[model samples]
Target: MVDRPNKPSAIAPAASAPQPTVDIADDNSSITATLPSGENVTVLLHGATVTSWKSGPGAEKKENLWVSEKAVLDGSKPVRGGIPLVFPIFGAPPANHATSKLPQHGFARNLRWEYLGKSTSESTTSGDAGTGPTDNSVKLDFGLYSANLTDEQQDQWPYDFGLVYSVTLSRDTLQTMLNVRNEGQLGFDFQMLLHTYFRIGDIGSTAITGLSGVTYTDKVLNATEHAQAENAVRIAGETDRVYKRIPQSTTSIVEGDKPRFDVVRDNLPDTVVWNPFKEKAAAMADFAPDGDYVHMVCVEAGYVSDWVRLEPGDTWEGGQRLRSLL
Candidate 1:
C-alpha cells in the first residue's frame, strides 16, 4: 500500500469575507455603495443623480463621471454634471403638446427622489467549464411619483405615474434602469433620457463610434437634418445633434485608439451628443471654469425622438449599461 501522508486535520471553512456595503448619508442627501475591490458609486437623492463613479483600487483608481466644480448640489438647481435624469420633455416644450407647459427637460431632474433600498448579487464571466472569478455587484433603487411632485409641477403636466430608477454598480460596469408605471385612470405621454457625462483626458483626442450612416438633426444649426458621413465622429465644433433610430445598440467613446467607454442601451433608440464648446460654455453660470468643458462630453441615451404614450395600468421600461474600458 502506498504510504499516504498522515491525514491532515480537516480545515474549517474560512469565515465569510466582509461583503460590499451601502451607506446612507447622515443628512439623507446621498447614498453610496462600495465594493470590496474599492470601486464605488454615489447617488444624490436630489434628482436621483449619479454624481460620482470611481473604478479600480488605490493608485489605479479613476473618476469616470464628471461633476462641475460650480454645480449646485445643495438642491438649489439641477446639478450641472454627472448623469442627470431627464423626462417628460427633452428640451423646450413643443407648442400645443401635452407637455407644453412643462419646463425644459421636465421636472424629473429638478425634484427629490426617495431611496428604495438596495440589492446585491454576484456575476461571473464565462470561462473554461463555465466557471470564472466572481464579481460582486450592488444595486440601489430610487422612486418618484406624482404625489412627490410640487403643486406647481403638478399643475403643469399632471399625471399619476410612478418611476423606479435603479442604479447598479459592479467591478467594471455601471447600469441604470428606469421603470415607468402609469398609476392613474388617464394615460400620459412623456420622454426619458440618461444624460451621462463622461470624463476624458482630452476632448480633441476623443472620437465616438457606431453612428456612421445614421441620420441626425442638428439642433445647433437650426434643426437641419444630416447623414453622418464618418464612421468615427470627431467633435470639431459645437455639437448638439440628436441621432435617431441608431442602427446598433452599442456606442463607444475612444480616445487615441483606446476604448474609454462602451455604452449599451435597451429600448432606447435615440442618442444625443452635446458639447457646449467655448461660447456657450462661458454663457452658463453653472458650468464653472468654462474651459473645463474640454475635459468632458455628454453621450446621452433616451427615447426622445418621439413621445412614449403610457396607458393606464401599463408599464414601460428602458435602461443603459456603461462599461468602463480604462
Candidate 2:
C-alpha cells in the first residue's frame, strides 16, 4: 500500500476555478478522483477494483457503477460488483493448462495493486480562441507484478509479467486500460477481461445493443454455441453468454428508448453478458439484497474467446471507455 502524505497534495486550482483532484485515502487503501464537472470515481487497491463512478454534475449526479451492498472490502475476497480485473485465466481453467491450479479469474483481482500516482489533462469544453471553461480529466494508474503475488500464486502460474491498470475520469466518461508486459524469457498464454457491473433502472426495461449476428456461447446451456438473433438483447432470467468477435466496438445499454451507457472497447474482441437473476443472486454470500439483481447487469469486455500468447519482452494492451448517456 502507498503511504499518504500528512497533507495530501492536490491539483492547484487555476484562477479560482475548481480543478480536477485526486485523493488517496488516509489509510492508502483506496483513491478517489473528482472532475471539475462534479463527476467522480473511486478505486480500491484490493484487486484495483473500481467501486464507484458518479456521472453528471451537481444535483444531477448519479451512480453509474453497481456495487453490492454486502461486498467484502477488507481484502478477504474479490469484490462482487463494480469493475474487477480478470487476467491470466477467465473462469475455471481446463485440466493440464498452465493456470489449471489457479483459482477462477486468476489472481489479478484477488491481490492488492500498487498505486502509481496520477496525471491530469485539460481541454476546452466550449468557446473559441482558447477562451472556454476547461474540462479536466484525471488518470490514476495502478500496477501489479509477478513479484507482488503470493508464493502460492507465483507457483501456480510461474511467469514473469507486469500489469498496469489505468482508470481515467473525465466530465462524462470513465475509461479503463490494461497493459500487459512479459518480463521473462519464456512465452506465456493468458486471458484478460474487464468485468464491469453497470447499474440500471430496471433489467426488464433495459436492452443491450450492437451484438446482433454474432455467435455466442451460452454458458447457461452447457456452453453451447448459438447465434444472436435479437438486435437488442434483454434479460428475463439467469443469463450468461459470451459473445465472440464482436463486429462493432461500441455497445449501448438502453432503458426504454434512451441509452443509459455506451461501452467502447479497444483491442478487446469479446464481450460477456451476465445476470444472475433470483436464485443465483440469493446463493452468493457477497451479493446483498438478492432482488437487487434486477437493478444491475454485467457487460464485460475481454479477450476470453481465445488465449493471447505473449513472447519474451512482448506487450499487450486493451481497454474500454464507458460513457453515461443518462
Q: CA lDDT, every prediction? A: 0.92, 0.94
Per-prediction TM-score, please?
0.94, 0.94
Q: Among all windows of ten consecutive residues in candidate 2, which has the lowest summed lDDT?
A: 8-17
lDDT of 2 by residue, 234-266 (tens): 999999999999989999999999988999999
lDDT of 1 by residue, 195-225 (tens): 9999998899999999999999999899999
Model 2 steric clash total: 0
Clashing pairs in 2: none
